[model samples]
Target chain A: MDAVLSIRDLAVEFKTDTGLTRALVDVGFDVPRGEVTAIVGESGSGKSVTANCIMRLIQPPGRIVAGTIEFAPERALSSEGQAPRAPRLRAPPFDIVSLPNRDPRLQELHGGLISMVFQEPMTALSPVYTVGNQVAEAILCHRDVSRRQAWRESAEMLERVGLDDIERRMRMYPFEFSGGMRQRVVIAMALVCHPEVLICDEPTTALDVTIQAEILTLIKDLQRDLGNSVIFITHDLGVVAQIADQVVVMYQGRVLEIGTVRQVLKDPVHPYTRGLLAAIPGLAPKGQPLATIGSVVGDADIETPHPLRRLADGRQVSMPQDSRG
Target chain B: MRSYLVSRVLGMVPTLAVISVIIFTVIQLPEGDIVSSTLDRLQAQGVDVTEEYVQNLRAQYNLDKPLVLQYFYWAGNFLTGDMGYSYLFSRPVNELVWERLGYTLSITVSALFFTWIVALPIGIYSAVRQYSIGDYVMTSIALVGLATPPFLLALIFMHIGFEWFGVSTGGLFSPEFEDAAWSWARFADLLAHLWLPMIIVGMGSAAFTMRILRANLLDELNKPYVVTARAKGVPPAKLVLKYPVRIAINPFISNIGLMLPGLVSGEALVSLVMGLPTIGPLLLQSLLNQDMFLAGSLLMWLAILTVVGILLSDLLLAWVDPRIRFE
Candidate 1:
C-alpha cells in the first residue's frame, strides 16, 4: 500500500525560560491510501502536536526541531491503465517541515489538499460569523466559485454532515447550536474542500459518549465516501479499537508500536503498548480482579502513594506522559 | 427594550438629582454674601453700591429664599424647560448655552473624527509590523504624545506655525467670517484655525487609543480563528485587516464613552488657550463670575452629551459584534 502521508523522524521542541524542552522526539507515522490511522497515546503524548506540525499550526516557542513531513500531490494521479482516479500518496513527495513558512505550495495544500478538525468546536470557530459564511469562506478561498455558489456548496456540505434544515442553520451562529451540532458544523467545514487527508486531533474527545459514537460513524462514512485518508489522534483505547484500521502507539513523543489494529489490539507488542492494554478495564478477564499496568509512559506518576491494591495480575499503571493527546 | 429604556430614563432621575445637589452646594459654599461681593467689586471700580439695586436683584432672582427652596425653584424651572435668564449675560440661559454648545461640539466632533481616522491605521500598522523599525518609530512618536502635555504641544506647534507658515493664533473663524456666507472657503479657513488646537487636544488623547488598539489587535492575532483564516490561504494583508479591524475593533466602540465625555468637558482648557468661543471657554468665564444660570445650564449640556455618547457607543458595539444580540 502506498503511504498517503509520510512523516519521518519528526521532533518538536520548545524554547522556554528554563531551557529547551523536547515536546516530541523522533516521531514518524504513515497513513496508507484510503485508510484510517490512529495515533494513540495519553494526553501530552505529542499526538496533537504532531498533527499540528502537519497543518503548520504550531506557533511560537514550540518549534519543529527536525523532521520531514511530505505529502505528494501527484499521488492523485494513478499510473495504472484504469481511469486516472484521484491518486493517493505513493511515497514521500514533498517535505512539509522544511518548506518556507509562507511557501505558495503550502498555501495551495492547506485547505485545498489538507484540513483539520480541532478538539474544541466552540473555540475553533469565529463567534461573529454565521456558520454558512465561514463554510462558504473556506470554499471560496480555494475554489473559483462565486459567493452564491459557495453558499450553496456550504449548505450542501452541512446537509452531508446530517444537519437538517441546512438553510436555516447556516444562518445561525455556533453558539446557537448544541455541542453535537457545532461539531458537525466543524466537520462540515473541514470536509467542504474535499481535502486529501483529514487530520482530526481528538475531534470526538469533547463530545459525550453517544455523540462521540455518532461523530466517529460520520467520519468513517465520510472517509469511505470521499476516499480521503484519515489521521485520528485519541487517548481512548475503545475509540481506537472501534475506528482505527491501523494504530501507532506513541509514548513520550516516540512511536512505541505500529501495526494493524488487529495485530496491536489482539496481540500487542512493546512494553508500553502492553501496559496501555492492561490499564483498560473491560478488556480484562471478567471478575478476575482487573490487571493494572505499572509505570507511567509520559509524565504520569504510577508509583505515587495511592490506595494500593495487590492484584493477581501484579501489573501497575503509571502516569502517562502528557495528558494532551 | 421598552423596559430597558424605562429603566434608563428612571435611572436618570437620581443622577440628575445628585447633580442638582452638587451644583447647589458648590454654588452656596462661599463665606461672603453674593450681594456683598458684587457690591464690593462694583464699589472698588468707583461705582456707588446701592441697597435698592441689591435688594431688587435678590427678589427678582428669588435668591432671598433658603438654599433648599432656591434649589427646588431652579430644579422645577429646569424640569419645565424654563432655564431662566442669565444674570450676567442678560439673555436666556438655555439660548446662551445651546448656542455655545454648537461651537464646542464642532471642535470636538472634528477632532474626534481626526483622531479615529489617523490613529486606527497607525495602530494596526504598528501591531502588524511589531518589533520592526516601523513599529519602533510609531511607538516612539506615540510615547512622545503620551508624555507631553497638550498645552505644551499646542504652544510649540503654534510657535512653529506662526514662524514657518505665517499662521496667526486667531479665533476659530477668520474675522471676516461674520461678513462672509457659510461657504466652503469660510469653512476651510475655520478648519485651518481649528486644526492645530484639535491636534493638541486629540494627539494627547489619541496616543492612549493607539496603544490600546495595538494591544487589542495583537491579542486578536493570537486567536485560533485568525490562524484558521491564514490556513484557509487568506492573504496576509487581508487576514490582518479583516480580523483586527473588523472583529477586534468591537472593544474600541466602548472607548468612545470615555473620549466623548473628555472631549466635551476638556474643550475648556484648549479653547481658552486658542481663544475659541466654545462652551468650555464660556462656561469657565461664567463660573469665575458666579454666573449660576449660564454655568449650570452649560454643565447640564455636558452631562446630556456624555449620557448620549455612552448610549451611542453601546448601540454601535451591538451593531459591530454579531454575538451581542439585543433580543
Candidate 2:
C-alpha cells in the first residue's frame, strides 16, 4: 500500500529538573494512504508525544531530538501554483520537521491538509468562544473566506458531524455541551478544513464506552465520506480492533510491531504485542488466570519507571536488539 | 441580566449602611468629644473658652446623644446633601469634596489608564516570550516597581524635576492655572505635572497587574485548547488573542473592581508627596483631626464606590465568561 506519512528514526526527549527522559527513540512507521493507522501504547509510552510532534505542538522542555516526518501528497496541484479547495485535488508532500514554523507550506498543511482532534474535548476548546466561533476560526485560518461564509460553512460541518440541533449547538459554548457533543464539535473543527490527514490523540479515551463506540463510528463514517487518512492514538486494544486498518504497537517509545489488523491481532509477532492481546479483559477463559507479559527481555541499563506494567505471570518479552521485523 | 444587576445594586444598600455606621463609630473613637476639642482649640487661640460654651455646642450639635442615634442624625443630614462640615476646612464637607473632586479624578483616571495601557502588552509579551531578554528586562522592572515605595518614587521624580529641569513638579498645575478657567493652556499645564503622580500611583498597580496577567496567560497557554488552536493553523497572534487570552482574562476581569475603587479614592501617600491636590490628603487630614462627619462621609462614599466596582466587575465577568449562567 502507498504510504501518506512516513516517519524515519523519529527520536524525542523531554528535559526535566532531574535529567533527559527518552520519550521516543528510533521510532518509525508508515501510514498507508486513505487508511486508519492506529498507534497503540500505554500512557507515558509516547503515543501522544508522537502525535504532538507531528503537529509541532511539543512545547519547550520537550523536544523532537531527531526525526523526519514526510507526508506524501496524493495528487498534483494545478498550473496556478494554488491548491484546489475541493478534496479531489491532492496536496504536495510536506517535510513537517525541516520547515520553519512560519512557512506558508506548513500553514497550508496545518488545519488545511493536517488537522488534529485531541482527547478531552472539554478542555480542547476555549470556553469563552461559542462553538461556531471556534469552528469559524479553524476555517478562516486557512481558507480565504469572509467571516459570514466561514460561519455558514462551519455550521454545515457541525451538522455533518452528526450534531442534530446545528444552529443551537453552534451558538452554545463548549461548557454547555455534553461530552459527546463537545467531541463532535472538536471533530467538526478538525474536519472543517478538509484536512487530508486527521491525527486523533485518544479522541474517545475521556468518554464512556457507548460514546466511544459512537465516536469511532463517526470517525469511520467521516473517513469513508471524505477519504482522508487518520492516525488514531489510543491504549485501548478493543478500539484498535474495531477501527484501525493497520496497527503500530509501541513499548516505551519504541515501535514493537507494525502490520495489518488481522496479522497483528490473530498472530502478534512481538512479545509485548501478544501480552497486550492477553491483557484484554473479558477475553480470557473464565476459570484460569489471564495471561500477561511479566517483564522485558533486554534493556537493564536503561533505567526509569518502565511504562508497561509488570504482571504476575512472570514471563518477560523484550525487543530483539538485532532484528527490525 | 436585569436580575443580576438588580440584585448586585440592591445588595449595596445594606453594605453601605454597615460601612456608614462603622466609619462614624471609628471616627468618634479618638479621645474626647468633638465639642471639647473645639473649645480647646479656641482656648489655645487666646479666646476665653468656657465649660458652658463646650456644653452648649455639644447639646446643639446633638453630640450628647448615643453613638447609634448620632449616626442616624449624621446619615440623615448626609442623605439630604449636607455632608455635615469639615471643621479643619471651615466649610461643608460636600463643598470641600466637590471642589476637589475633579482634580482628584483626573489624576486617578490618568494613573489607572497608564497602568493598564502599559501593563497589559508588557505582561502579554513577557508571558509569550518568556525567558527572552525583553521578558527578563520587563520582569526585573516589574519587581522594582513592586518593591519601591510609591511615595519615594514621587519624591525622587519631584526632586529631579526641580533640580534638573529647574521646574517644580509638586502640584497638578502651574501657579497661573491654579484658579484658571478651562483653557487649553491650563489643561496643558495640568498634563505637564501629571506625570510624576501618575507614575507614582500607577507603578505598583502596573507591576502587580503585570505579574497577575503573565501568570494567568502562561497557564492558559499550556492548556490543550491552545494546542488545538495552534494545530488549527490559527496564526500566532490571533491564536493567542482569540483563545488563550480570552480564557486567561477571567480573573483579570475581577481586577476591575480593585482598579475602580483606587481610581476615585486616590493613593494617600503618593498624593501627599506629589502635592497633586487630590482627595487622599484631604480625607487623611479629616480622619486625623477627628472631623467625624467629613471623614465618615468620605469613607462611606468610598465603600459605595467599592460595591459598585464589584457589581460592574461581576457584570463584565458574566459578559466575558459564557459558563457563568447567572440565575
- Number of the top-ranking candidate, with lDDT as the measure: 2
Docking class of 1: acceptable
- Candidate 2 Cα outliers beyond 4 Å, as residue runs: A75-80, A83-91, A283-287, A295-325, B49-56, B64-66, B259-266
Q: Please, what are the lDDT tens digits per residue for candidate 1 over residues A72-148? A: 65444222232333444352377888878767666756766788887887777778778898888888877667999
**What's the distance in Å from true for residue A159, model 1?**
1.9
Chain A only: list TM-scores of all candidates: 0.84, 0.87
Correct interface contacts retained, every candidate = 0.47, 0.90
Provide the lDDT at B163 for model 2.
91
Using DockQ as the measure, the top candidate is: 2
Clashes of each: 20, 0
Error of 2 at A218 (Å): 0.6
